[model samples]
Target chain A: MENPCIICVAITGSLPTKANNPAVPVTVAEQVESTQEAFEAGATICHAHVRNDDETPSADPEKFARLKEGLEEHCPGMVIQFSTGGRSGAGKARGGMLSLAPDMASLSVGSNNFPTRVYENPPELVDWLASEMLEYGVKPEVEAFDLSHILKAADMHKKGQIKDTPYVQFVMGVKNAMPVDREVFDFYIKTVKRLFGEDAAWCAAGIGAQQVVLNEWAISSGGHART
Target chain B: MENPCIICVAITGSLPTKANNPAVPVTVAEQVESTQEAFEAGATICHAHVRNDDETPSADPEKFARLKEGLEEHCPGMVIQFSTGGRSGAGKARGGMLSLAPDMASLSVGSNNFPTRVYENPPELVDWLASEMLEYGVKPEVEAFDLSHILKAADMHKKGQIKDTPYVQFVMGVKNAMPVDREVFDFYIKTVKRLFGEDAAWCAAGIGAQQVVLNEWAISSGGHART
Candidate 1:
């Protein structure tokens, strides 16, 4: 069979320290440039999170707009996907970018305890956000922190809120979420295939040491690899 | 809420070697002893695989009977579960011990590629196995290699072959199956809850280093954790 068609490059997501990886982009121009580099690296889709000039996570629509405009100007055909995950805000505030309506936006399927806090997308918020995405013709990339999250995404799909063939992103390696291990990786793919079918597309992002391994697995398994 | 009641201990499963861990039991008596130790270590459920005198994998009814009798003689109250997974021999021959009718027997939900081979449970075999287990009043522990496997298990449940609220086991870390990583674990749990609801009980076993971590998570999350 031909390999899966999509490749998503997550440029400048939350938690990249300048001390750890100086290459992480903090400014809109840097974000755009990084995205361009990924696009040239065989990524047809780009999943992005914007950072402020000071390198902090930002939910500012203006930042998203800047990144979106830059991508449109630099690589017109690339699919620009933005994060609705606030990384530092309430549900309504976290998904503020939904109003901006990019080609795609993230929708976490369920809630789980992160390293020090809980990241939750309440059912009410999920319902509302999903409706808005559908109304605006924006595809929701169901970001699953755990298996239940994929179920939640499936629930949304069944309720006619999310897209029929929703795109899923398996976020691995978060402490208290799922560990970054091969067993967990295999479980996640199996869970996704169980919840969604051949029509659904999946990508994986492993935290820390797992990122490359998960990326390679996704590529080989006919699933998209989101870096 | 009360802590999850189940603790599954996989004692010397089909894989793993004496070279890896000296604790892995080889003989039938050793297997029973280790199983008792695991149960005493807080595992209420024991998943077993019979090995020949030479330490090769064996699905012989006699080995299984010895295991069951040994467990009964040593640890009377502990639940004994057997692997119906025939990694060797003809599929029909794999069910030799089903006549023993232990409390539970694993029914692999679907098939996937392993490191060196492909493990497929054809539909006819699955149906026959499910019917036999049901007739014998043996609870089938639906083993899922991927998401599709879970779906197949669900189908079995709907057909009334498997019991309602079927116990599902997410077998992680097998190549060509789901990887044993945090993200995959999260996806597996979430998917189970989403598909089966909070009423469903699930367990996980991570191959290699993930084993301990999965145990901790399963215990904390109110699910069964098998080593």
Candidate 2:
């Protein structure tokens, strides 16, 4: 038996602009081109967030549609995942693009502290996003910022809110949130396996400079990695 | 060597009015009397929240001051801890009672989802509350609603934001939050001991019906219990 690796590339995050990194892609065309390049380099997943003309984060469904079209045309078969993260929008606006029915969408099941503020994912908003994903036949990639999020995903799955087995992705190294700790990383994997299953598909991503460390750990542990 | 057990009693929580239970105390006088009874019944710590005449939660310092005076007079030598929980107030108003200089105050170092909403403890607000506790010589009983909160308490203690070693309380069984799970509870205790010290004092609280389970776990593990 052989196991295949899934490499996910985040072309543009909700944060970061040309000011932060000159190579960071902002526009739809730039994101598509960059993601296509990454897709050609063994990247099978593209996690994306759109930006406004002034390089600010935007939850505009129109922008998401354009980006989705470009990615489908340029990087065929690459998993396109839209971010329903709080950074891009507030309230229901965050799930506006779920109707596009991307291959997968990031769903935060619980709230946690971020670098400078609370990453507010209220229960109602979480349920609403999960419902939207179910409506559009979008697979939810549960973003586990903390331990309870994994459990919350399990509870949501039991309640028929999340369709299919939840693909959980552990996020670590955010200031005031879960920091980069090997023991915690191990516990997250253990908990995911315990709740989801032994052969459950799980992934991990570390923020900023710690990304490479998480990638190494995930690959070595026979799990997926998101950069 | 004898390990003394500290039983903390929450006389008046932010939620649960007379409608929920006829014995639920709302007025300051009722709170003092209820806490006095609990204190005499082996509960050495009084965790309290003030309520308005309409049974709504209030963060008024005057009400807190009155409660403080009554607790000191009625339940002398018993620890008086104010609740800075989100249900009672928002932003700096949550820490308004720190000026009263109670023995201890509850501090949520990170955010998590509540039953209906996101318990919004923003980074700035958490820092400000910790600073207020430090300034007023009030010991903060860090509320560990989720795993990262315990780690955050350690980080705050290292940075001098928390004046002393944190007394972290694991709060479980809340809807949409960390539920009462034995594995998770054990891991919480392990994490606290790893981050703080092996001899560090810890406590656990379970919402609603699971309170007895958590109390048993805490007592058997040589930790404290909060009711």
Candidate 3:
């Protein structure tokens, strides 16, 4: 049999709000309900970013704790991945929820440009987040915003920063970051195989409209898919 | 005969003070003298950043004007490229010297991590700098710190933000950014050719100890080189 593909669903990202889409889950209860639906639909991993009452992204550990408890009860056996993404918070605040010890957390190993701003991930911050994940026994879903980020993850893994083999997720089609290019996407896969072993697992994610395109590409290319 | 290689000499970068190297040029007069020597020694381009009296990086336009005047008087036809690098200043202050209109200016199309901090080049600031370069009639030498930067340059070119075909410089071996990897180096060249035409000009730059290695690699690969 071929390798089984793990479908990861980002139920609610930091940017999306009720204004953009009414179905975007805002409260902890809504997040758990939405993720349970995704889990029922065959998504084994639920990547989440919690939001405040007014729909602003939040880094509150209290909220994260509640979300974790809810997911554990509602989506039982599904892998819970909290987003340590920049939009929710700044500095170490972004990783404050790592102590909740979710199954996994998204970690950006390097900095890159977003739609309107520079996604500031300093080297010290990256190291600190990786260390936090290590302490909490949280597996990191290495977010590769550009090619160098993959290399950075490899370097970190080699240096004992990342205890296990990094599970890289190639993010493409951001406004000012890596765009959706077939050649670059192929190179990303080749790089992952070259750095990690041939059997190493990897995934890909695309922004907004490119999500479907990337899903097709990843699924057809023998890699896992993220939405 | 093959196309001639354009040797660019970064006489003084943002860092490197007298404590690090006593020979580093700090004042405008010393920079002019150092660049003149480099020009005589087969360097056809001078990449420069001005420093304060205390040897810290400065974005003072008056100093840049004096340096441009000195270089024009001393080196004659050598290409003068002022650096709008992040280390010297923040936001639009980095492009304050664009009105002086040197032959070329170094423009970073995207952001990445430097040794210690996030080298911030926000989207609005990048567009503003590119626009300033266009208004001053100065050709931009796009600095590619990571892979996405090259694609961003191509996108900017298609949008007419960069008036001419971009002359890209691949920068490698920064602590948190792209390292000196031969496979990546070759891929960078291939991507440049694939995006720009096969005949388009490109260059390579390596930091500190990797400088000679990149120069040799670039020279052997038929691309221009910088030190």
Candidate 4:
């Protein structure tokens, strides 16, 4: 039984702020330090989103460059992936950091409801983000909030919008998105294997306290676990 | 196996027009006549969206009232369902005609991608639509565009948002939305039975050329078909 596991660390996502946790890293310097520490703790992938000084989200490529520089200096051999999610920025700004050409970038292939609003990854926007990822030589971890999204990723791969086998990440327990049902969890794993192939790697994520549940599901099921 | 299938006719959806089909029924008179003909042809439910004189979609309750009156007059005893869909209007306007207290209204419980953009039914909007349906004593045909919507409908039913066992409709073959997939189709049926009840009525809809396929699938599978 080959049970090698990949540990991915998402330091700062779009929603969490300093108010949510005093330890939440917002500034580029803080993010770099946080990634360095996470990498030292055996995190192979450092997934990051840059924020402004006032704790507001920012898509500035300069900040990403600085963080990338610091991570290279402090945590060599770490896979750096930028977040192209909707909350950080609107439209093309979400993908502005992709030009820095990190090892990977998160790409949501379809639209689903967030807690408060629609997480809109329109067809053109999804196509544009995939193109940018391709241009920057970055791999996309297709964020699957729903089953259709995994199918959408397959459609994109067939159209050559996504270059490699889409490394899918199942996002569950979001307020209005998919929930953490055991049947759905098992079904997601089956669908991913059916779509991408049995050998392709995948991951699962859950918001807030349910994160541990998804982590256990992914790790125990022979898939990657994201924190 | 006594499978008595319900036949629902969608006379004028938000998108189709006189350009798409010369007999699209723009005015209330046209809709009334068209419903009469469809009813005469053995359609049990008349699922309709009112249009203005120029064939533009309208959420005006006055037109809906007129259409309702005419439908009752012409197609006696036929179930009338209004479209509370986004293309007809924005925000509260989608549910404006629910006050007419038609037998049913189409309600999308979750958001998913449409042909070109996101079909945004935010949580608040979904709540509002469900509440409006409850207030008006109108049953909701839960429009399940994606897998989560069927689950969302279950949640709503448990929470008393939907008064009756939800009748879910599987919408497939939309451009960027859920495409027509057989495995997904079978899973949708299983999900509806698991969530609502084993005997809960369900329907299937396929866009354009695939409508016949969905009709055959639904009819053979003991579910309703939407035309």
Candidate 5:
């Protein structure tokens, strides 16, 4: 039988406003509930972003532990992924997620001018993050915002920071990153295959309306489509 | 001196409704004016989709002739590109733009289900289109919707239909096309480079807000940026 496509539902992201979608989870209970809903919706992975009780983004270890515990209790078999992205420009802030030691954590490979903000992950910090992920047995999902980001990921893999076959998530549709278009998509995918080869597992995520389009392309390109 | 970036502005696309953006030009005169504005805004190339006087989408050759004439009169140096994308499944409905035979015409490399529509270009038709572009001295901008589309472009190039060192534009962020995201961006770029090597001149066009992001990435990636 063919392997089922791995569906990962990002429950609470760092950027989405309550004004955009009312269903975004904020509290611990809300995060747990959202994870459950995503699992029920056929998501094999649940990406958690811990939020303060007041709905502000948080990377507190306690909050992550609570979320992990709650998710494990609610959906035992679901893969739990945590966001290591601290607030923009706060590279040191990624430590919170690392302390929790979840099964997986994001490692943004390069810096780009994100929407209404600039994300500058210094190369030293990136190297340190990669080492930490490896030492902790935490899978690092290389969050690449552009082609250079993928190159950075490949560099880490070459340096033995990441496993030979690492997981890469292409984040598009953000300002200063790759555009949400077919040509950009082709360039990005083609670049990854060239750098990492077919041994690597890849996924795609697009902001806003691009989300659906990116998912469909992932399916067509024989890559895993995450929700 | 650094190579100047080639900016292709879609002065008038066939898809956007007036309600979405009133600035969208509909008539031939309006398209000419928009093209001139884009030229002034540093766009050396202009991608056009003709519309009827009633604001309906049109591929009428006369409309293209009128627009071309206006462009030639207003901006002599600007490269005008015509869209071969007929509405819906009416692929044979070539009209104004195809007849005018401008310097460039978009040749979609593959067919896929568009939102509520289907776009299919058979191999025979692709070969014919390629021959037509070559015969008319019009360069074919192979518009790839996915990875397979890039392969198709490579196949056409191998068949000597498309010119060696072919010019390609990856169109992402369409519903049925590749996603406008980083992973897709990496894969697409890597694939094109691998298939076409250093000889190919490529660009990326993202739908909506992704347009800016993709353009920026293209500029940084050592390719010309065309909207």
Candidate 6:
């Protein structure tokens, strides 16, 4: 029998507001309800980023605690993943929720260009975040903004900074960063296999409207996708 | 017969001060004397940066003009390439030397993490530098600190931002940035060929002890090398 795919849903990202999409969940209750719906529809993982009352992104552990509790009660067995991305906060603030000990958290192992500014994940910060995850017994979803990021994850894993084989997600189609290219995508898979053994698990992500394109690519290529 | 390799000698960089090595040239006179020796030793290109009296980096075009004049008189035909890297200055000041119209200038297309901080090459700065190079008729040596940078160079070429096929340098072995790996080195070559035609020119650079390794790889794989 074919191995079942685990679908991950990003409930509320660091970006996007009611002005962009009125249905984007902002409050804690809205986030839990959204995750419950996605869980019912077969999303095995819930990737979350908390938001303040004013619709700004937040890295509040209290909100995460409430959301984690609600998800446990409403969508039992679903893996919870909090975003440790830079958009919500800076420095250690981004990882403040790690102490809550969710199933997993997004970790960017290297820096790259975002739309207008540099998404900074300095080496010290990367090591600190990985150590925090190790302490809390949480798995990390390595965010591969470019090819080097995936390779850096492998290096970190070998050095014992990461406890297990790093799970990398190839992100594409972000403006001024990596764009979607068929050949580069194939190479990314080859790199993952070469670095983390042939049977290692991996995933791919596409921003905005290109998410559909990544879904088709990931599904046909025997990897996971994020929505 | 094969295409002869063009050797580029970077006499002084933004980092690595005279304190690290007494031989590291900091003054205009010292830099000229160093380049004269390297030029005579078959170095076809001289990549340079200027410094203040106190040994700190400077973006002074006047100093650059003096260096260009000295290189012309002392090492005629040796390609003079000024560095527009962020370490020496901020914003437009980084490109102040472009008006000198040296043979080339280094331009970073994307951002990545350095050893201790973010190597910030924001989009606005990148575009402005490229445009300045275009106006001054200076060829840009696109510094590819990571894989996405090479792709960004290709995109700029397509949009007419870069006047010609970019000369990309794949840099590796920096902490929190791309590290030196054989497979990745090979992939960088393939990516360069895939983006820019098969005949397009490229290069590779490595920090500290990895320089020898990248030199060997670049030469054997039919690309330029910076020493």
Among these predictions, the greatest TM-score belongs to 3
Global Cα RMSD, each model: 18.4, 1.3, 1.0, 1.3, 15.6, 1.3
lDDT of 5 at A129: 83
lDDT of 5 by residue, A1-227 (tens): 37568888888787675777898778889889888988887888887777776667787878888899998899989888888885622656675567667888888765544444335565567777887787778988888666556655666677797875667888777643455667656666777787778655788898877899999998788677766
Greater-lDDT candidate between 3 and 6:
3
Model 4, stretches more than 4 Å misplaced? Answer: A1-3, B1-3
Instruction: Tell me the DockQ of each model, to 2 decimals.
Output: 0.02, 0.90, 0.94, 0.80, 0.02, 0.81
lDDT tens string, model 4, B12-78? 8887888988988888999999889989999999999988877888999999999999999999999
Superposition TM-score, candidate 4 onto the true structure: 0.97
List runs of model 3 lying over 4 Å from the truth. Answer: none
**TM-score of candidate 3 relative to the true fold:** 0.98
Per-residue error for A159 in candidate 3, Å, reads 0.9
lDDT of 2: 0.92
For model 1, how does the per-residue alpha-carbon lDDT over A1-227 read when each residue is reduced to its tens digit?
45546778888887785776999887889888988887887788888887766777888877888889999998779998888784845667777777777899888655444555445555566677788888888898887765555655665687788866777888877653565556556666776777787555788888877888888887787778877
- Which runs in model 2 stand beyond 4 Å of their true positions? none
Clashing pairs in 4: none
- lDDT for each residue of candidate 2 in A1-227, tens digit (9 for 90 to 100): 27899999988898898999999999999999999999999999999999999999999999999999999999999999999999899999999999989999999999998888888988998989999999999999999889999999999989899878889999999998999889999999899889888999999999999999999999999789999
lDDT of 3 at B211: 96
Q: Across all candidates, what is each one's fraction of true contacts kept?
A: 0.00, 0.94, 0.97, 0.70, 0.00, 0.83
Rank candidates by DockQ, best first. 3, 2, 6, 4, 1, 5
Determine the backbone clash count of candidate 1: 31
Arrange candidates by lDDT, descending: 3, 2, 6, 4, 1, 5
lDDT of 5 by residue, B54-92 (tens): 677787777788888999998889998888874612545
Q: Count the backbone clashes (under 3 Å) in each candidate.
A: 31, 0, 0, 0, 35, 0
lDDT of 5 at A74: 94
